[model samples]
Target: MESVSTSSVMDILNLLKACCSQSCNYIMTYGGTFSSLASEVGQLKDKSSDVKRDVEAATRDGQTPRSEVLGWLSSVQDMEGEAESIERKYNQKIKCLCSFPLNVCSAYRLRNRAEAALATIRELKQSAEFTKLADNLNLTRSIKMPTTKTIGMDKVFEELQRHAKDDSLSVIGIHGMGGVGKTALLRRFNNDFPSETEADVVIFLELSIDYKLEEVQKSLFDRLSLTWQDEVTHRDRATKLFRVLSTLKFILLLDNLWEPLNYQVVGIPLPAPPSKCKIIFTTRTEDTCSHMGTEKMIKMECLEEEAAWNLFRNSARMDVIDADKNVRIEARDLVKECGGLPAALIVLAQAMAPKKTWEEWMHALTIMKDTPHQLPGMTNNVFSILKLSYDRLSSDNMRVCASYGALFIKGSWIGKFNIRNSWIGEGIIDNVQNVMDADHKTQFLLGILHAASLTVRVHDDYFTMHPMTRAMILWVQRECGKKENKWLVWDRERVEEAPAAEKWRDAERIALVWNQISDLPEAPQCPNLIFLDLQVNKFLRKIPNGFFLHMPLLRILELQETSIEELPVSIGNLMQLHYLNLCKTRITSLPKEMTALVNLKYLSLAFMKYLRIIPDQLISSLRELQWLIMMDSYSGWKEGQSCEGGVSFEELESLKRLKVIGMTVSTLAALQNLCDSPRLAPLTH
Candidate 1:
């Protein structure tokens, strides 16, 4: 697995040239009789090849058996083996240089036998024959393809033909439920799209995961057989590909198109006025399909009842579908519960696949009856069955995490990118100990919530949760404030420890933690408390007394996590403080003395929660402060809260410590797109 760097590939090429040169020179010096054979071997090579262009150019012009003589010289080198055992056995290492697609072993076997036979010639010092043998060491490179076919895609051929015929500014889309056949279909196309046409170049780009515009552009440029040899940025790469597309008729299959992006801004052509170039795409939403302006949006129909029955038959493969009438009836009932979504149908059918009697099917049906469905336009009901796993968590963070389902309970496709942005904007994530490059802040939360079954990861970095799970989050948010399992309080047993850990955990737990807690906690320790979220809590009128001294660990302490409002004078003692988020809190203004925490990372003096002006010192001494989320969370005063990031990513770069972290997804599309974090391991709510 050596990296294919220029220096490495170049070094290899140099060594190969030197080996060929030595063999050729040794042959020409020989006064042997194998001249005719050498001439024949040299004739088989073309000048454009690596061996011919480099080695053949230097042989004595009229020399006939030059290579023939060198092939013999190879025996002399072998016999003069630095160590006697070198020639004792043929190692694959020697013959691996032979140009073949991993047939290095076979090449070694043949070279080994040649060595054994030529050992006699080596001992005799037949310089001519040894040179001839050396010249015979031919190595060439060959490309290889995987032998077996990738499974589960039956619609590839049809799509390929469609793309080929409509190559003029065309947009063919594939829309279906998660895990059905959209991505797989595109994958199959990626594998076999290049047929025989010279204008035929296929490039596949994923718009969901790792949605960096540069990545898409680079993939397209590479496929078009073009290279700038310069650092092509995200913007430039997109531009380069667009320029290429305008000339060459290429097949560009944009996968997981969820948003209505202006590709032109990124240097690619728009879909509205067809350019007579084929651009096939796949989306889960009809709205996205329409935006592409495709002549035909194949609204994928659900698997037919017969198709569902067959899926059940294949999955179950039991006698229930054959002999027992009552068993068959129950099996049919199971399929109905799956709603004909292929992913659900197969997953559900498989659980019952091995069952025999009617009673087992009946019990399963009973369980299915209990699970709830997502809201309108959010048909994520199939996995309500998975929500049962969340109930098993023992932690409040775990329970609060169950609320992730509520966002999806409404059938919202929470793209991973937008979710990451939401998590950051909402201030759910704080900092992490470099478990896996702390750069991935939200990923940790994703893993924890996913493990707790409070979130269901969907296609293209999108995630969702069942309505029941969303209900669980609401319950946890309400319960987090209770004295017994208060989400805002630090470990009751370890109050002097870090309330930041407790508060941070609770903040990340709620759909909007700032909206759940009334004020910051009073822990004597925990300097890692960077975020203070006072978002949703409506009960408070002022900050806790001496709150600043008690929470020296406070970075961003938001009181909006509950119904409380107010600011305590002791809030200024936090020296290591960073982000101070008081979005929905009822605080009026920061005390001029509290601006002493010169390390504030982000300071939001926004109004909607109704604060007027930032502390005069906050505008100056707190030099490192960056992001400011001052917009309304749905008019913070009343019930219908709007949770959106009011700050722009561009303006926040001035803070220096801030990074545009996480894969951000827009709320309008999907939520599951960004649930890639594994660090939120112990803190998922």
Candidate 2:
């Protein structure tokens, strides 16, 4: 080496040291590395077994293992196999001597590989310390509801669908009267929900008159599969509900909301601007819609004419309706009487389905027109269902007025002025001295009834009552009492004779208008009779002498459009009569006994063209009379002398409290008498 330097010698010695260190370490550490690898792999295997046991238990408990957990278990399995192979190879290597080059090399490489495997096993074992091994898989999102046949709901469905597509309309309301297909519409809507991207969950609840917050919460928890801890407070449950509902796209269909529901107290988060949640409810009153903060309201109306006929024809047997030409005519008339209401149409149709003859159909029509409550399904099925609306009225006066409205025949337009006067006269609207204020209050109450869907407004001056609502009122009056015959309404029917005497014994109100009765009951003992209407009996020529004997409580008596020519001496026995209508009758004289009517407030003698005589002081005897209508009749008036056996103008002017007076003045003297008296001029019509 041509005199090598000291630096070169140092470099050679360092290289030799590194090479020996590497080789010796690999060869010596094989046993320790192998032992460590086996230990770690065994630990990992134990952890894998533990994880597999946990996963199996979770599966039995209706849960699914996490993907990462399953992956870790697979890695551990691979690690175990590799460790076993490495152990076998190490054992073989150890059997040979460390002096052999091939055995030393093989042991060194195997030791390195074993150490790497051990590191991997350690990593897998650390990762195997999982906090949660599985996820719960029992949660259900939506349940389907039963379907029903629907007709004439296509337009309503289109409107609902249109509103649903609008993100701005989070809360929708369906408002209508009771028995007007509100519940049916809601069911249909619930059945047609949850498209692929529409909602993740759907819930339908019936919050009728009786619903509580806890009950509602319990239902929601059951649907959501939440742990409903009985001991937990409502606040805690609410919090849990909010937390869970916040992550879902949901729809809640609420049916039959009598009043506004408090969502905050129920823990239902308001759906809105960001979250995809919707709420829809059905109500009988529009005020509920307003109170519930509905963004869109769909009003339910009675079916149209064609639709009503179709529904009726289907509900009734088509064969029955089309049996004969006469049957078809009567069926059409019956359908007209239903006033296009689907509930009434269906019920009435079904009731008439079994009738085989036109005569039976005509009889059914008569009953429906006169006493609808007497129809087979009218009282129990139709009116009772509609009674809920009447019962939910806010005040007794509202309920009374609603029932009073039923006195008007179905489909007849009632003048607003007429109703107001009738209400005032019947003491329904009392204690208001100012006429304007009373009229305003009456309008306000009428508006409330209109909003409640009990009455349908026809125009600014008139409104009409639905036939089914009227029937419900009548049913309440007649059947919902111990005395089921309290109200006897037989108006505008083919009554050839009067009802039995027992039928009138406990009656409070009796109407027998537009009948063909030739004779009256000789003596019907109606002790509780308050209103007796015998109007429009064309053949009613005379009232028996004792007809009004036992009716001591009689207040309103109507004998208009009859053929009676004389007032019985017993007419004066009705001391409590507040209203008396004798218009269009053939009466010619007033009985002298009429002087006993002291409480008479309303007297109508309009169109009594044959009226020619008035007992002296007959008009003046009515000290409390406020309204006197004699239009187109009873114009035989004298100034001071009762010479012509007619009413005296001074006697008419004697009514100091009279507010409305409608009369005809056939003579210039009578016109001058009316115009000269300033007191009666303003009140005259």
Candidate 3:
């Protein structure tokens, strides 16, 4: 609002007084002032009775003259300046009040106000002296609200810019639902716009859901810096408007509408082809867009993934550049967890960044899991989110990791994106102690985590973790008890359901707690699966060969309760398998079929409750297996017993890559010329 400057008001008042002075010369050349002319005004009133007959006859015939309007306006002095202020105040209010919800009665009220503004404009125009001094620069109304930068709207703006360049259209309307960024989009468009030179006037009118002609006129007059008579003949207002706009072109904004369009309702002249004018509007209804005959009827849709992620990163203040290496890794995991819903991504990213510790991250994820999913689109609550993540894991490792779920927790605010886990820090290896390159196990772990969909991306280095992952982790922990809680009975199912073809996966890193269950489910069929954590299912006996046949992405398999086991000759066929755990189980002998496990990285056979025979050929085929674990004394040292491993160092050339060894029988020095393999690796080792 202009705030109605005191000087401007005073000047308008003085001009009104001066007009009265000159008017005194025409009718009664001798007069004191407007106050003194009260008597003369009475005389005019007396004359009005005589003309009343003629005026009444014309009024009955629907004819009103400019002279009649001027005569009425001439009598008013105190209210002239006040009228301008009043019109402006309401224009600002109506413009800001929103135009879409106007029912028929509201339309009338707005129409009346616009008519009143037109009357005020007409009255002000009758003042010849004021008109001579003031060209009347109209001000546009309906200020824009603050906006944020997101990616997807760039395409919308570019489309509009192309239209602006074409300059062939007379009108453009951007239509969409509330809070979907229509207004924000328009405001951004208007602010960065470069087409102002084409129109003499750019005016914004609150179209009152339906275009009542008068409201349009008022908005136009307000923009033109024109005023009208408070009480006037309609012809006078119309004439004044024509006189003002005859030389100018205008771009009118008929915004926030919900009803059908009719331009004439605004009392503006309809221009012929190449009208060189425009009327743009915004509305939630498509019908509104079509009825207006907008040249470019643009509908606003939701931001896509990249846009959502950018919005989240920007909102969370998580620019990857400033983060340290460790923190950057954590941030990457964080963004991946919060899928690209604009609101949820931002809310979650902001909440997680302040607390950089893994502990806090875990807490946040747990919270989001149990909380209702109210993220973008409100399409689906996070029902199968955990299952989605579970589905992404490699087939052979599914039950292993699923059974290790942690205890579930519900809380006030939950965001799947808030959790971050360092694959190393999460103790994933204790379940798969057989696989580790001495130099970079931690970094490798993090990579494996991302590949497994346990973590997802937000930015280059920022990631997010789903809460269900933590819930899975917690469920497994509760089942198996803590690593420190050795005496607890682990029984609850870690994973309840797998994902259907159409669903989102929870991408949170997890570890195995195989000490928790006694059985494994049927193998899965997902080809894109990755990690498998089945470290300690004490009653687990058979592992299906088909487990790894289809899941080419299989990475880690943790099966610790090997005591209740026998390896199918097919166990060696998991070519893509990286980490394998057979910790503390009973196997009478290693199968020669194990020679086919060329990609095997970690093989854990430590803490076996009973002795087991080994197949020497198994060692030769495990060219990539890095870490090895086995119990020693249980080798069953019977006289004349056939030993499965007696290979010389010369034949163990493939053992050069070996690093950490958890073994009971196989001697690495005798095999690889290194010192004997450890009976058990150091706790830190």
Candidate 4:
């Protein structure tokens, strides 16, 4: 009993000693622990500041904060608040309990709180060491772009969206004329990407009139969050881009593609079969679409009339447009002048929005009709945009050939054959030895023009220039100074009579088509004249005696569907004439003097129902003649028979350069002559 009692007393004594020792420790370590907590909290605050700074910088560069980093920052904030609260309580307890050693309970509670906060602060400081402060923003999968309200593009947009999701299609192309809203459509397409798309990233790039491959490379690098090193080689950059692109599903939107760009050259792997990556591009030419190997092509046509008015009314505000009947009339007429092109309509509407009076509208209309490009917004926005297509043409020959579209009436469907022949006659297509080669080159050039979107193909053998495009071309030509001044165009100028001799003196090319010119000057000293078009001059019955005398350098003379019945004797003086079109004329006979034309290459007399005679030797004397179209007009061939100095089929055999001949034979002898001659028989159609 004595031993057990002694053990129990010893345990009680040990417990009291332990309590006394813990109390002493709590009192002694309180200040150090609080200091430690304050120091760690300050360190955490500094770390948080550094991290926030880094995050801000990364965000400025189009990056976003990492999820883990954000969580850590939030934890640090909470820890800082707790540490601050503990410090305030400790300070308050010390201040209130100063010189009073009896308040151990308050001191103990404050010490306990500081100890707890110190531990938390230390943990936060340890976690503040972040290798990466922020992650890439990944350039939003679909950026909301600022664009004009879509007009007549809902169906096209829906169709494009379907094509974009199509499993079999990897590349889609949108092609149309300049200022036809291709870029606008692309912007809308990019902004309206579905949330459920499989794409992990979408990159939009605008290849300028002369974009470089490095520009594309840099865009990829930026969007992919790869560091761009300026000192690296192009191949190295391409490899880097390809490495990242191969692992992710992405959509690349390429806008304003002037020509075919090799995807491989730019380090873009072709999204061929089995690849989830896709590419879409917008260009002004279908040729680009074909060359780029697009799986689907959507042609962006001009808005319909009603849709155009809607767009215009929205832009110009309907209140002003419908304020007066005259204003509405003028507005509708102005829309027609815009030719349903969105860019033109938008610009014109904006320019006309401020003018409320009918007179002001009328003045604007007159200016638009006369010089559309000179209007306020037309030059900068519409015409200059169209000029890019012309400026990026492959060569000067193409530019010149394209400029010829301006010579015709605006918005007219130009016959491809006539255009090709005109190109041949102007010496634009040189260095060819045979008519076949010339035709081949002509076809290639036509393809180039079509691909450039300078001319829109209406059919296989016809193309038409947009009215706005024509106006832009004419403006460009006029801007080239004196060189283009030689081209005199009066077709759309509302000129009833031929210009005075002074206007015709320095002209190199003249277009007097669709006019009521009843007479021409006796002679104009046009020493540099190369082209003259008198087409569709219904009232023109006679050519002055010396109309062709001074045009020694004349190369093309067109008088199709004219009322003229005879050619002047001076017609033979145009020694350099290459193309002579008298189709649908009233001429009954050809003079013998036409035999002087040795350089004539293309001669068309088709539909000349009143044509009856071609003096013998006249056709053969044109040693350079290659194309002769007389089908449905001249069938007065009589072989081995003398009939009013008429041309025989056998005489056609003498012409060695003729490659295409379209004429009819009315006599058996003529048919036999045609079959007997190897050259003529092979060329005859």
Query: What CA RMSD would you report for each candidate?
Result: 25.0, 9.1, 25.2, 10.0
Residue 484 C-alpha lDDT in model 1: 20
Q: Please tell me which model should have the higher TM-score, number 1 or number 4.
A: 4
User: What are the Cα lDDT values of the candidates?
Assistant: 0.47, 0.79, 0.48, 0.82
The candidate maximizing TM-score is: 4
What stretches of model 3 exceed 4 Å from their correct place?
A: 1-145, 150-152, 176-178, 205-221, 228-247, 268-272, 319-355, 358-685
Each candidate structure's count of clashing pairs: 108, 0, 72, 0
Task: Flag regions of model 4 displaced more than 4 Å.
Answer: 1-144, 196-198, 272-276, 427-444, 480-486, 490-495, 607-616, 632-638, 641-645, 648-650
Tens-place lDDT per residue, model 1, 66-162, is: 4544453443344334223433332332322322224434434544444453445334333232312112111111112232222323444474556
lDDT for model 1 = 0.47
Tens-digit lDDT string for candidate 3 (232-309): 554555655655554456656666676666654445554444766666777755555667776778766556656755
Over 130-246, each residue of candidate 4 has an lDDT whose tens digit, in order, gives 877665456567656678878788989999998888878999999998888888899998998878887878888888777888988887777776777799899988876775566
Q: Candidate 2 residues 1-685, lDDT tens each?
A: 6356677888899999999888777675557677778777767777788889988856643456888998888888788888889888766653546433356667678777888898898898778778778764455556766643456778898888778767878899999887778777777777776465457677888764877788888888777766677898989888777756665677888888988988877778889754468888999888989998898899999888888888888775668666599999998888888887878888887788788898998998888776777777777777877898888899887887787677766667888876776666566655453456567878888888887889989998889899878877877887563455787776666687988888899898887868887788888999999887788888999999988888999987888888999888888889998888888999988898988999887888899999888888999989888778889988778854536657777887787767778899988877988899888887787
Model 4 CA lDDT for position 523: 86
Comparing 2 and 3 by TM-score, which wins?
A: 2
TM-score of each: 0.34, 0.70, 0.33, 0.75
Instruction: Give the lDDT ranking, best first.
Output: 4, 2, 3, 1
| Model 4 clash number | 0
Assess candidate 2 and give its lDDT. 0.79
Instruction: Return model 3's CA RMSD, one decimal.
Output: 25.2
